[model samples]
Target: MSDRDPSVSDEEWAAFVEAARKDGVGSGSVPEPRRRGFRRRPVRHEPEGWRTGPAWREMNGRGRARRQVKGVVGITLAAGLLLLALRPDLITDRLPEGFGGPGETAPLAAETARPTAPPSSEVFPDHPTLKEPFKGSPALGWANGAAGIEVPRAKAVGGMSSEEVAHALDSVKRFLVAANLDKATLRGERPTGAIKLLDPLQKDVRAYIHRSLDEPDENNDPLGLFSRFDPAEVRLAGDVVKARGRMTFEAGERSGEVQVHVDYTFVYPLVKTRPGFDEVARTVVRRQMAFALYDPAKIMTTRGLLYVLRMDESAGNSDCARDGDGFLHPQFSEDLINAAPLPGGPEIDPYDRSKDLADLPKACGTVTRT
Candidate 1:
């Protein structure tokens, strides 16, 4: 039902009718459309730079540059490490043979120096043969000829009777004295007459003796003492005697003729002191027999050129008297009858009998004795 006025005049009715007509024509008021919960979605536009295109491409270019730089740095670091790992000798300087540096050049020929003496070659060929089967023992053998002189006595210091041992010690003392006297003569110093008897009358014999004296003390012991030089047995054959003893090498190996711990002894009356002593001395001088296998031809032809100036004459004299320092003074010392080796040196017996020639493999190295 609609609410309306009950009493209406004609004019009032006409006016209301007129107003209704005007409302119908104009639709002055209409119910608002019911509001809905959902809202209109907004339109999306691309960002300013993206609209230009190639946005991803530009980003990738910068990323690629960074990766390339990283790769280059990595490679550079690896190259540096490689250089550090490889230790290269840098000096271009060339030095003479035996110079102590990587730049110093060693003689190619020297690497193969070996025994060349006929006896050494015949006894010890490049390889062993039946003829050279008997390599001398440190105790005894003829390095060059018939086996060396015999001692006739073969008792150990401990094994010998008290009297025999006493005699042996006395002999050693005498040998030392004789050796000292010989060293004096070699140095142009006054030598006891006893020294002349020890002197090698024959050139070859003297050379052999000198070689023994000149042998370097490969052992680094400051005293310059050999590791071993012990004698065991001496077998006499006429004038020649094969004195056998154990000789210990620096390497501590005991092979064919080398001994670990035994002294070799051979004694004879001094030729100068005793008339007709030449026969006894010759018989007893086992150096010939012992060195027979060594090749004399292999000695170094290259002489040291450096002049040893301001050398301590007394110190040098003492060194020669005991251990020969061949490098500094190749010439044998005249003060003592025996020879001395040089400092920073090589073997006194330069002869090469690499194998059978020396009846043993030649030993040499920065840390070894030849």
Candidate 2:
């Protein structure tokens, strides 16, 4: 009819037409109106604060990773420092040359004195096999047999000719080898070779040796003069014997007499006599003796033969309670375990050759090591 419904007011009709146009209801091509539920909701924007957003989370993650890395580095550093503190030798070994200090060289472990406290159970650590008899002993590095007994270059001293001094030193070395290193002598046999090297006129010395061998007691121990072991009880671990020491000559208390001082330490490796037993024990014997070489013209004494003026000896790892059976009885691990408590005495380092054997306390003492 009149281009609008008669019941509709003009304002209402105008609003309806504007709404239809906005909705594209009367366009050349009509489009369907969108449904209420079909419209997309506007995106909800998060807060702009850096500490509460994704960017903040990324930075925080990186910081946490860095802290973890730092923690690991700190732990490693602490462990390394603790290791260095506990074993300084490791550091010294790795350091470059000249790092120790100017004109300073690190001392070898073998050279340094390792004076340990008296053992509680055994005289020496147990070596269960004969493969390495000298294991855990300073003698491991010592020269074998007569090679260790190096004679000094002979020189005239106290009015003796160089040739005479040389001959005297040779004689002393031969006697030492015979008394200490000879296989037969070590097996409880009489040290005939050693005896022959001595002056025949010294009947007292010969008689004493013979008596000690024949009737050995606590006072007249043959071990004081010879390194003998009972063949029935123990045998030499190997053919090698470790030795180290020096010999020096000076003027004797009388004219035409050259006194040769011999300070030597001999290490003997022994094992049980039983065929199945393989336990190795070491006996350390240090002998300090003075031999007088008298001139035939001036002193009217035997030529080339050495006269025994003094003899002192100290032994390590031997049974302190043993009453001299003419052989050394080295204490083994089992012996220590089953035996009575060892007698108390001063602790001595058997490897310490710096002091004279005579200076050691003349008592049954515990040795620091074998």
Candidate 3:
């Protein structure tokens, strides 16, 4: 099955020998095949295959070492790439942010996406209902003083009975007092200059009077008179006290007025020199609340407290705290008393002789401060 002229020709062998010599074999060269060969070598057994035979075998070790070096280089390159991908900060030398600065906008977490306010009544089956019922004449109505009332919400909502209004006002005051006290304590503040002067005198005078009168000590005192009294209660007037004043509000570039009359009538339960238990228990709250109102610093504290109370008791113009009787009720919202404006008004006055607040409405923000 071999091809014809199986023996390599002498001329071809000579050319192969010359090529091998040029390739730098020192002395020995490929033998030229006989022109008429004694034994014919196969034609497929060409001289081309002879060049690679011994030289390739001899270089096998160097080739193996080169392959190993390439493999190591590849592994090192792959490891470096892996490290760069895994920990980018290592390559880029930048510290992570501790917390966002004022300039930064931090990415919101998943929890922040949840709703903050509770679902409104429209979404729930059973929820507490709020009431707001008020109406007025659009032209020259309560808001415009055609009728003698000057409440902003009330102008639209109409009038409330004296009892409901008083009760609501008292509740708000109690809540405010507690809040003021808490805020003062949390901020590590002490009584101010005015308070220090008045407070010490008040305590000393009351103590002397009680001792002189031979009042039972608080421990033995069946009646809690001294224990229950607020520091602010002072007899500014006679047994029957009366304070009359007026408040002015600027109504859309116009001014409006409301008359205010405050009366305090003290009842002496069994005209005795000593404090009575009934009096201690019954009047403790009233006395403290009265004192809180007396402080000169709290003149315009009324606005926020009153606003909140009104918003809460919005069931009609009538108050949530009204009784059948006409007289105002006095169930104080213990925490909210001090919020009411102090009786004397703001601390500073240019005219030392000025008797009443010249600009309370402005301070309350009910009207513009012209």
* Every model: Cα RMSD to truth: 49.6, 40.2, 49.2
lDDT of 3 at 359: 20
lDDT of each residue in 1-370, candidate 1, tens digit only: 1013224444664464456445553233321111101101111211221111111211322111100000000000000010110112211111112222232233212112223441221110111112322111111222221122123332333222334333433333343233322333323323333223322312322343344344533221111111111011111113222232222111111111111121232321111222332211111111111100001122111111110000001111012222223211111112224422222322221122232312221221010100
Q: In angstroms, give how far residue 8 of model 1 lies from its true place.
A: 99
Name the better of 2 and 3 by lDDT: 2
Question: lDDT tens digits, residues 295-364, model 3?
Answer: 1122222221221100000000111122111111111122124333222222221111122222211111
| lDDT scores in order | 0.20, 0.59, 0.18
Residue range 25-102, candidate 2, lDDT tens digits:
424433221110000111122112211101121133211110000000000000001111122432333332223312
Worst 10 residues of 3 by lDDT: 69-78
The order of the candidates by TM-score, greatest first, is 2, 1, 3
Name the candidate that leads on TM-score. 2
| Cα distance off (Å), candidate 2, residue 230 | 0.3
**Which has the greatest lDDT?**
2
> What lDDT score is found at residue 323 in candidate 2?
43
Give per-model TM-scores.
Answer: 0.17, 0.67, 0.14
Candidate 2, run of 10 with poorest lDDT: 68-77
| True-vs-predicted CA distance for residue 230, candidate 1, Å | 31
